[model samples]
Target: MSTPTKVPLGSLPLPLSSHTLTKNLTPDRTAASPKAFRQVQHSQPSTQRRARLLSPETHFSYVAPNPLPFPFKIVPEEGEDVSPANQAELIERWLAAREALQEKDITERSNGLRLHFPAGREQPRELIGLSETGLRDCLPHLDVGDAFDLLGLPRLTKDPTNEEPQETENPARRELIDILSGYATLINVEEDVDKSWAPWSLRYSGHQFGTWAGQLGDGRAISILATPHPSNAELTYELQLKGAGRTPFSRGADGLAVVRSSIREFLCAEAMHALGIPTTRSLSLISLPELPVLRERIERACVLTRVAPSFIRIGSFESLNPPESMFFLGGGQQEKDLEALRILGKWVGRRVLKLEGIKWREEGQAGDAWGRQLVLESARRNAKMVAGWQAYGFMHGVINTDNVSIMGLTIDYGPYAFMDVFNPYHICNHSDGEGRYSYQAQPSVVMYALRSLLTSLSPLIGAENALGNKAVSPGWAKDMSDEQFAEWRKQGNDLVLAELEDTFQDTCAEEYRRLMHKRLGLRRIDLDDESKLIRPLTSLLAEHRLDFHSTFRRLAYFKPSLVDSPASTGNLESSKADFDAFVESLMALTPEPQMVDTFKAKIDWKKWLEKYSERIESEKGLWDADEDVDLQRERAMRDANPRFVLRQWVLEEVIKKVEQDTKSGRRVLGKVLQMACSPFEPWGAEDNLSPTDILDDEVLEERRYCGIGEQQMLGFQCSCSS
Candidate 1:
């Protein structure tokens, strides 16, 4: 292991002398009560401590030759212009908000932790925490200072927090959207900008499998900013900076994410979101040009600001264990745990699962009927989430407890991939050499993670009530208690049944077998009749190892009569005409002559064609004409089976672009920010299909290779590398 660097917590560089601090302003002396005065006195020391911490030299190194760029700019909030008057008012409001939050003790915590508000400043810059090596490494290729020049944004010197600030006709509300839309880049300044701002975060820890992994806080990331949805203001989005520097929980490692990994995360999040999978959103990717750090061979690093409804991870809860445990804010020990779980569960159930009116109550408590409902809803939502992943052929390489979200949103994108080919088992992570996270193993892994999370809530579930903690025990009606237990059992059973159903549905079965035979130019087997379907399918499965997708598509188009009939001399001329036409068309694409011969040996082509025609005529309804039946066949032929996949390869290509730019020291700031702000719309450029569009044979070949690998591989690493 490499030696870790010493990272310092910085101070805020606000112009306090020139401006009165809003948070510390004295209220009207006569209006203040005695109790209020006492409270102020009690909190005075901490405020002084914060002020001391905010002083520049104590927190930062003034490296002048590499002076930081001014991070904030004035951009349009809407299409409306930003006038001087409006700007002044906006700044005042922002200042007041910041002060209010601070007065309520919402500022940065101890150590290097800080909050960052992208829209709070005039020109929003990426928050550079003490452990921000990732941004520093990518600064060479990225012009952090001039990132907004092409997007029609201008530099502004006036303070955004001024009480009576200038306003513009069109002022940008936040830089996150522009950066994501390929419009701006976030720069970092060491001397100026408030270092007092701490990212919004929750403390948590968890059990890794059955073993306790204590106090696993956010070792690298922080939620620094938020943006409310324009139309529905009630829904707010949290913008978190990953690898933005160190925090109290840094664990002696650089708090930065490598470019290679950052790109993977950015692309994967976007891909999953597009595929309709629940996942965290990537808002902006910023590269630090100056700070260099070594990771897997000194590669450049980058910071990705991600957006999500909540940043609550399983790890967050886990961190608040015995040592960090505190009061439940209003009540008893178990009460706190129960409340936390209930709140988190309800949010997950409603937002991620689209389930409304989910309720919860503490175990052994009177109102636990609601709690039971929350659990069931969570299970159903999780079941659907797993099914969606399977449908898209995606494999989440890592299934760590900490990585699993209560909301079922995929997070911490690492070695992951969509199956290139049809394989029952495929693994994506090379590190997971044990195949713990395989393509076929995801469902089980997810279940295991869920089970572990539930176990964490055991304390709240009153597991120790049998031992008699009078304060925690509810000596209520047995009927109510039994009902809660029964509900859990029912939900558990339903979850199992759902998983089984998904597995059964995903198996291609008869359709898959038929397609394989068709692709290999084998005799077409009739599936309409059970006997006919069984015999030929078995024979083909035994004879050749055919791929599921290719086989299914071919069977969808196969003309069975072409292989089951042969020519007789009595009608050789007409039979020969039809046979020649079929052979010519078939041979045009068939690579091996033996394949055609093999097909021919299995059936009499001419005879079968005659029989097929006769059967079609006989099957026609007594009053209906045979022409109608013929028309149906024609229509089926015209509607070709979909031979192409739109999800996997396309996503891979997009991920590749994101990865390349990140590696080359060009920030994906615009790409990610746009995605975070408007997840449904395409970001940047008119042509939105660059990743999916095929430019040449090589591109097709690459996709073919990826598809095939996906099918045959097992385990996270194996699948992802392939």
Candidate 2:
């Protein structure tokens, strides 16, 4: 091992404002929070012998880059001048240049062991296997600096506006690419050259619609290592490869992901993170020109490495409670699996979630109190997550128990959608014919997954162990007397089933209402207005099938600046007149030229406006005498609405534009990431893109360049291929 070196824990040389650089250094800290980034609730525990970000460097290994699979190098008719170039020769030269890099990260191409699940602990072997080989010519599409902020590393000094990477202007940007692309590029961080970390795979099981499918784990993803978050030593984050290669869990499929799916996840993950939703953050996207994968047709494969505090999932625990088909793993030997489940429960609930002492459990006969707490907290967060989805009109097509993250972030974004016309019944995934995971049914699906998880914990907690309406294994308390087993089940049911039911329902209701209030620009008030204001407005929109996103975006621009401010606080007449003009403008608003089925003359637009305006007027009575109710309402709306969303058509346009031209595609993807990453960048007290559909407006003219809104993407179809 190289002699241990002491790097300052307090600070490092980073190309970021002190405010942005150390924003996350302090554990559970809200110091200098960036407006663009949300303060993630989960953080590493401070393991500070001192404050230093250590790099766990491994030995250098070189393998020739793979050539792009044949069909992707689309050729013109025979004798055409166009010919595919050699990828291997180019990759060799690239590797030669980066050979000097010997940083601990070994060139951040994401090779890390999971947070070291103890050996002999019986982790699902299928989930922890060798990473598929043949990592070839990595073409960097985009790297997000905000994601690196979690590490508190030297930032790339991000500017979403630039469609092209300005690697020349900022050396840190180049450094970020090097580290994330698995090149030996070190900016200003500490390293450990002696110790090399191994990669880990995880196993999980999920219900297709409500039935358990056994041994479904991280089929194509492998976690190489987990270390303390750079800024906050308290929390640890695992960087893992998605679409990297195959694992033992690959079943019959090739463990690969195409560039299109990779880009979707890359942008959407960042978009969700920026929107303040708890999600796994993406670091970098690398595409291999020649790798091929079968989707609807042949496509090039790519890899995306994402960061998360912990990748533990409901399925992680559920796998220990395997499906009936795999009952041999548990069956009469169930206690062994139970013990393993408890160990994992404690690790995730205590080490990761920090739920300890009484917060984790009650003093009783329970063997794993953390199991119950994990389920409860998962339910609470998932409840809010669903609420966020509904408020933002996001339809998560698949909420399979396996896809449902224990961390409560949206995982596995296959065939998801953002509803345009407020159809609570909309199904985003074309494969989900029964609407089992539709917009309105998300809560039930989320609840079903939680219940499955809760039931899986029965073995750990000594309760009735039944899932999928059929027992996966024999009951955990089978040895107990009938009375004891019955009592244990009753108490456990009341604690988990009854208690979680109430909490989930109550929390989801209040939180959904809270989100809707913000979307509609309503000021704080104790009065329940589901029937009064919200429902009526929703009814109006639904009746006419008005565009959900555009309607809300336009609502944000409706506030007359002069009248809503504190200056006009007591002047009721002037406020009313200005508000009337705003209402009139909204009533006379025109739909985008492409709207064949949107809000129309048939709906009582003026009547709905009169009701909405009167409701705003009613808020005056609730505010303190000096408070500007209208202004508060507008501010809330501004924060809630986003001008740009990752509409399906937009993504398709990006794929088409970039495939024909890499340089041009990279530029377009950069612009898309910028808008998706900074959804709030366009609107303010200054430029107003409202009074018309943002698609037709010039607020961010480039957003219109994608040619998406000209074709409504509300019901665009995406299948399970992703």
Candidate 3:
């Protein structure tokens, strides 16, 4: 197909500025450029940037990739069109676009780094996607030869020009991968970033397995300060230093992470984000050679940079001196703790949620009007986030209050898994002994967590300052009896939980139904359609022990149409023969034949297929009525259900390869990363998008082994030892 020609809008050549990973593409060498290099000395993170939010002036700060890969580059002249119409283009076109440059046209210069915070103030730098910077070279795949040591990790060793670190902070070596993997050796934590910028610890309270665990805070995770993103200057990220050091919140163990756990998080974080799931983005992952920690065995230390708008959780509100305890006990201290909590709540709401009118100037009930609205917004985002999790087979092993993001992104990725099998009750996290955070229980757990948040915010909702004043002769007023108090109590109950529960239930159901509709390729969602189609498929999948993703892909090949039922035939033997033949025909459309057949052998596929056929027939006229309907239906279904999910077996094999040969391992991982990251690319030349079709035979053979020694990964035990 010929690519569509795009009309140019401006004559001003668009400059491609980036601190990219270098790749020696010449004869003897090949390299991948990291990020854009920032020359000039250290600058304060003050709001002293030259550009502001949504401004037309494209500054040096907005140079990094936001929705796309950071390490990629763009040049002047013929800019690439990334519209849906050009989705079928080769991946190499993107790789070669940057180097397709003009010598004189490209003016190489650095716009001395800009800061977001005020000058000369110690601020906390919470680690984020370790924006690619300072790396003179990029990492080679497993093809680099047998090299499995800390030395092979990607880092910024020096400036390419060997320019003295005059403008940029002394061009120091930055082993981003190892640093992010929780290795403390790569970065110099002792170096003072700024007079005002200093690392700080976060503290909050949360429930673990339905039990409230008090004073759980950032043990190893410390926030340095919010820095301007490579893409957006107005949007700042907290550069959290996870496993950097010990804080008061460091419960009882040393603040460090293991390589095994670090790599898993690094891969899963990007994988989730690529799949369009709201999650904390990972910038870099690094491993330390000699730094070993005791878990189940001697595992090397690793660090990961998990980037987010903010790391605040639902527990952040609960930690406030809440009025719930006082309301229940009656008569309490008139402390201003709840007032502070409300202030922070407003900041989070305005900064992140972009909701207006949160200023707490109003007195009494008016001062806390945003409280109920806050709960509703939080509920809506969490509902959608969890729904994404459910659709993609993500099992967040630990769903504690602290683990739940106020921003509604997946946080604290410990023992989480993109499940291999289609068991609704499957517990991916081994630490979740009671299965409270299992695949099926995610929605309920989130709802329950929200309810707790409401309980913590009750004080700000017109509950009067009860310090020492009250209608008291014996704690009761003679003018107003218990009747007046009872009325007040009832009104308070109405303000907190009543409307909020309705909002939570409605939003969750709506989001979930939206996802289900997509997965089933159904245009409309109703009780009839759900009962007749979606729900039945879910039940049948669980009963058959099928893989969720593969089974859905298999269903994409068949379009629904009303057909003669075998039972309609008068001859019983003939009917049986018809049923068998029907099943065989339907099975022919199946993807991943051997795996599907293993599950099909035990199930009543004939009956299930009949029900599904009836469903498609119900919507025969709604959509897919044309002769090309087969193409349209398949496109819709494939769009809704991704053929690739980061299954445990696949990830485990990749991990093992990395451990054996980082060179070859990196190459295979790069291929896997492409598929795992973007699941919605247009159909390739082969008319098949499955990675199993494209990967090397060795890798494909290993991917097929779902069993871990003896038992399958469904029973695999993973813990939060890191």
Candidate with maximal TM-score: 2
Q: Sort by lDDT, best first: what order?
A: 2, 3, 1
Error of model 2, residue 456, in angstroms: 0.3
For all candidates in order, the CA lDDT equals: 0.40, 0.53, 0.51
Quantify how close model 2 is to the true structure by its C-alpha RMSD in Å.
13.8
> Candidate 1, residues 1-722: lDDT per residue as tens digits?
33223221111122221121111222223112223322332332122111111111011111001101112123445655468777754543433222212222234433223322222312223321111122222111112232243222111112233232222322222223333221132222223223222222233555443345544445456554333333344454555667654433343455556555665666567556654567777644554534454555554546666667666665543432222243322111111233334344434444433455433334644332223233344444455566566544567777766777766678777677665433546666776777777777776776665555444444433422322322223422223354564454355334444443344334323433443332322333445433443334423322333333333333333343433334433465655565556634323332233434545423433333344444444444632364654445433432322233323333444445444543211222333323322332212221222666544543343334223234213222422312
Candidate 3 residues 1-722, lDDT tens each?
33222211111111121111011010000100111111101221111111122111110121111011112233323566666675334233332232111122122212211112212212122111222211101111001111122123221122234332122221112222222332221111112222111234454566667766655566567553344343344454554555544444444455667656766776777778766678876655444444556678866555565667678788766655333332221111222243446455555665656555554433333332455677778888888899889877788898988789887889888888876556788887777778999999998999888887776655444233232211111112224344654454345346767777787778777877888778777776777766776677777666555567766766776644323544555566766565565555444433334555444543566667777767666666777455576577778888877666666766677666655654445444545555555555431322543655765443343344322222354446578762
lDDT of 1: 0.40
Q: Is candidate 1 or candidate 2 better by lDDT?
A: 2
Model 3 alpha-carbon drift over 4 Å, by segment = 1-195, 228-234, 322-336, 357-368, 463-493, 561-603, 618-627, 680-711
Better TM-score candidate (1, 2) = 2
Query: Is 2 or 3 the stronger prediction by lDDT?
Result: 2
Off by over 4 Å in 1: 1-198, 317-368, 459-722
lDDT of 2 at 687: 57
Task: List, residue by residue over 1-722, the lDDT tens digit for candidate 2.
Answer: 23222222111222122111021121112211211111110121111001121111101111111112222233343454442474433333332332222233332322221111111111111010011110100112222333222222111123345344222333444333333332221222223212222233465666777765655666666554344533445555556667654444555556667777877777787778766667776756666555557878988767676767667678777766543443232112122254445546655666656664533333343332455666788888888888888778788888888888887888877788777666778888888889898888998889988887877775444442332222122233336565764454455555678777777888888888888887877766446578777777766666655667767766876543424544656777777677666654444333342442334532465555656666677667665678676666666676788867778877777777656655456555666776676676553223544545444233344546322264356578788876
